[model samples]
Target: MESLKNLKVGVIGLAKSGLAAANFARSSGASVFVTESKQRAECAVFLKRLAKGVTAEFGAHSDRILESDIIVRSPGVPNNLRVLVQAKRSGIPVYSEIEFASRYISPREIIAITGTNGKTTTTSLVSDIFKTAGRKTVTAGNIGSPLADCVKKITPRTSVVLEVSSYQLEDVERFRPTISAILNITPDHIEHHKTMRGYIDAKARVFENQKKTDFCVLNYDDKKVRALKSLCGAKVIFFSAQRRLASGVFYSNGSIVVKLPFAGYSIALKLKIPGRHNIENALAAAAIAAAAGIKRGAIEKAINGFRGVEHRIEFTAAINGVEYINDSKATNVDSTLVALKAFEKPVWLILGGRDKGAPYRPLGSQIKKKVKAILLIGEAAAKIRKEFSGTAELLDAGDIDGALSLASRRAVKGDIVLLSPACASFDQFDNYEHRGRYFKNAVLKMKKRFEKK
Candidate 1:
């Protein structure tokens, strides 16, 4: 591990990852100074970090922070931020919170999962498998708690299942996983990454530091993820949702199955999570488990009983035969599109939130087929209306409650009301989970009102 003693480190942004990075740095004896772009009034969380005796600057990052030996930033903060760029020009290295955390933790196997959709599902499924096999494991990273927060949980017998993202991967210099999986790459976070090429490059970084002995799992059905075999030195393992592979896992005849050199197993569709996408996630998890030498029985037991992560297509309520689904976790176009594919019933889709650079045009055809009508809200509403002008019946419902109200009036008994906003939730709520819970609460109120009639 590199010595942090007496080194001056600049931590940019006071978000969860940044706070973790600062605390870890200070604990390691580094002279840590924190800078946040958000104002002091907005940083109640920052004050808690400041109580630890670390110096901090809020509202704007100062030019003086460039004097540090290195800079570590939150994943939500763009690397091209003026202060970070200035640090780069000054010859000081900039690192991701994940990268900095890896240095302090003991060497252990890391199974990192990343994709446009299904990251949390795959990461949690893999973690379940490892834990069920009686192996010690910690789940963190982009899924919920930052990797830096959970690194201390790692020990010689323990493993980490991390849900990484393009944002986190972009800053990684040597953040190699013992086994890494690229679930699938679709058009996402274009506003932050700038281009599809840039986004793909960032996702591919999970495999950048892998050795020939390491394993890189991939989605064979996704051409982009399939082609990633050429980008890394790690031994590649492909998992498919389509036809059976010679070596990897595949969905066949309503069952999840895999064929590898060690042993092969067929997992009946026992996962409580409904959808073809979840099946693919199960297969991906199985591939990671097989690579890690976890027994087939243990892998099968954990995955079959795995219900799923909350907020991603979570069922909220049923009122007068109409089902409500809170998929507020669908913060990107592809994610909403995938959620739409999971159901065959006519859908009343609630779409909108803070715009985050996802192109909405590709959703036109899918929206036409699956969605009966759309209730729009938040900053992305106007842009979505323009892109999907004639795709479906589009209505401007002012907010989450407004959208739920419209769905109650417009949706038929057999129809599904799906809250699958193809944009981030920052405009109307704290995050996707908050947006999802709020939607669920609204539906519960709607259910109570309907029952009283």
Candidate 2:
């Protein structure tokens, strides 16, 4: 294991991960050069700030990228990019941010969670469970802080709960987690992954390097995940909301029940989080916690007290007898379906953003059954509208403000104004969190306006 000292590295893309990689490279005594797509002016400005230690070029692939000893690619950059292809041809090693970060970190147990949906929630829940069980745990990776930044803080006993993306997993070599969970694989990141099989394969790599002692918690409800039970080398434990599992965790008689092979008895517990998806997430968290030898009592306590992460079914201000809910974190059709199923009240559903290539038919059907009216926003609005034309009352609001105003106006007593956009937020907002915060602020302002009236 060589330190990154004086290593000549090429960082492709000037995105957040690229910037983090650049900073990490400088801190580790490595010289870095950044490259970006020709059209991005923001990348040019970012390059100017790094004028002293880093160099940048646009449009055509720079020959200098091939000169580097190693190339650290941002998550957005594909492996098949011309520069990356050239690097491989020149025998220059290429790695993702996660791979680069993993090389520098000391060996510690990692609990990596990856899927099309519920990765964030499951990662947060698992981290909470570890904390409740009295373990030094920190949630990082794709969720918030880069794994490189948190790696130094981890002790041998510290549990690293990582929210890994398929992009991060794509280039990993020796990266292995003690507990790897693939929540549910759905069609997402299709633009990058190209095919559903590729996406599934990328997610499955979370468990690819796990040893026999390592645990792989899978979603038994998902056909794709259940099919991998025979392929994975790690000890397989399943969690499902729809079916009762013989050994692992399942929902039984309105309570979460965990039946482990060694325990000989089933532990029935209550959950604070609503929805079957959340129940599945809780079961996955509990499975991981129990595998790590955490007490059943502690696991039960954590699941019951866990209020869930913000921006996922987060209740905003109630104004004039109308309740506003922000589920901006539901960035996929499957996630929005779960959110819709959780609420029984007639919903004024605010939906749409940058499409992730998921089929909108199922969501349309769910909307037909669950939502009263649909408020459309962002680039995918028209597509969603077309899908749900006669299924539900579809209204195009064009933007978040317009959508919110319309939903607020249409919402009546006992009706829910829900912002659970079933697409990526990159079109109208910075990210899902930004979208969620804006929705909350708008709801608060509306509440204030009604109070003044």
Candidate 3:
């Protein structure tokens, strides 16, 4: 591992990842300086979390940031930020927190997963599979905590499971994982990447640095993800949810079959997580575990016992015979489509948040067929309403609270009230987790009110 002794490091954005990076750098003997665009009062909590010697400037990115030898940018910060662009021109290296953290971890097997959807679920499953196989495992990256926070705990025997986003993968130079997987590439995050090709290119970077000895797990069902095989230097192992694969992991009949060189077995699809998307996610995890030389029994046992991560089509409560499903992690059009197909019951779907430049028109058919009403919320409400005005009943509830209140009144017995927003939650709450917790809490409160009635 490279030493950070006396290194002058600048951290951008004061979010969870940025704070972790600053602290990690400071503890490593680096002279760390943080810069956040939000005001001092706005980022007061994050400021309080900073390490003792770390200095920071809030409300702006001054010329002071340009003085550092290296810059560690948080995933939420745009790559094209003026200072970052200037830093690139000045020859001072700019790296994502994931890339910066990877430099500190040595002799560890890193398993990195990326895609528009199912990254968190697949990452969790992979971590659990590794742990079940008796390997020391740590889960981080885009799954709430930064990899920097857990790098100190990563020994030679450690298996690091990372849920890397396209944002995290953007600035990585030599950040290669021992086992890298691309679950599925859908049209999401266009607002940041600007185009479909740019977004795919960013996700593709996860495997760009892997050598021939490394492993690349891919989703064969997603044609976009499948087409990326030629670009990868790692040994490609494709996993499919749709058809039987001659090699790698695939779903055949009612079982998830693995046909890798190291292991071969089939486990029945008895996962707690619903939907074909999760089947793909499980297959991806199984393929990753198989590549890492984990035993068939451990993979099967982990897949079966995994209850799934929160906010991805999580069942919140059943009130007055109406079941509430919180899928606040469905922050894209394709994800919301997966959530809709996961259920057969009539759904009162809560849709819209901060728009990501993807059209809501693709969701029209599903809304017409399954959704009883489309409850609009956040900034994209008008755009969503315009697309599905005549396709289904549209309710402009404005936000999550109003949507739940309206759905509680209109939703009938045996129907589902699904919180599948199909857009980013930044408009309403801090993040998707916050939005999901709020919805789940509201549903529980609604249940109490129903009992009183």
Best by lDDT: 3
lDDT of 2 by residue, 1-453 (tens): 678888898988876677778777877788878777755564655565453576667665677888899898888687788879988898888888888887776545788899888888888888888898888887888888877666567777777889999999998888888888888888888888899999989988888888899889999989999998888999999988888777887877767777887543345656677787887788788888877778877777777888888999988878877889999998888889889999888889998999988778877666877788888999998888787778988888998899988887777898999899889998878789999999888889888888999
Write the residue-wise lDDT of candidate 3 on 334-389 in tens digits.
99999999999999999989999999888888888899999899999999888887
Q: What lDDT would each prediction earn against the true structure?
A: 0.87, 0.83, 0.91
lDDT by residue (8-33, candidate 1, tens digit) is: 98888887788888887787788889
The 10-residue segment of model 3 with minimum total lDDT is: 260-269
List the candidate 3 regions with Cα displacement exceeding 4 Å: none
Query: Which candidate leads in TM-score?
Result: 3
**TM-score winner, 2 or 3:** 3
lDDT (Cα) of model 3: 0.91
TM-score ranking, best first: 3, 1, 2
Error of 3 at 167 (Å): 0.3
Clashes of each: 0, 0, 0
User: RMSD in angstroms, all models?
Assistant: 1.5, 2.2, 1.0
Model 2, CA-based lDDT: 0.83
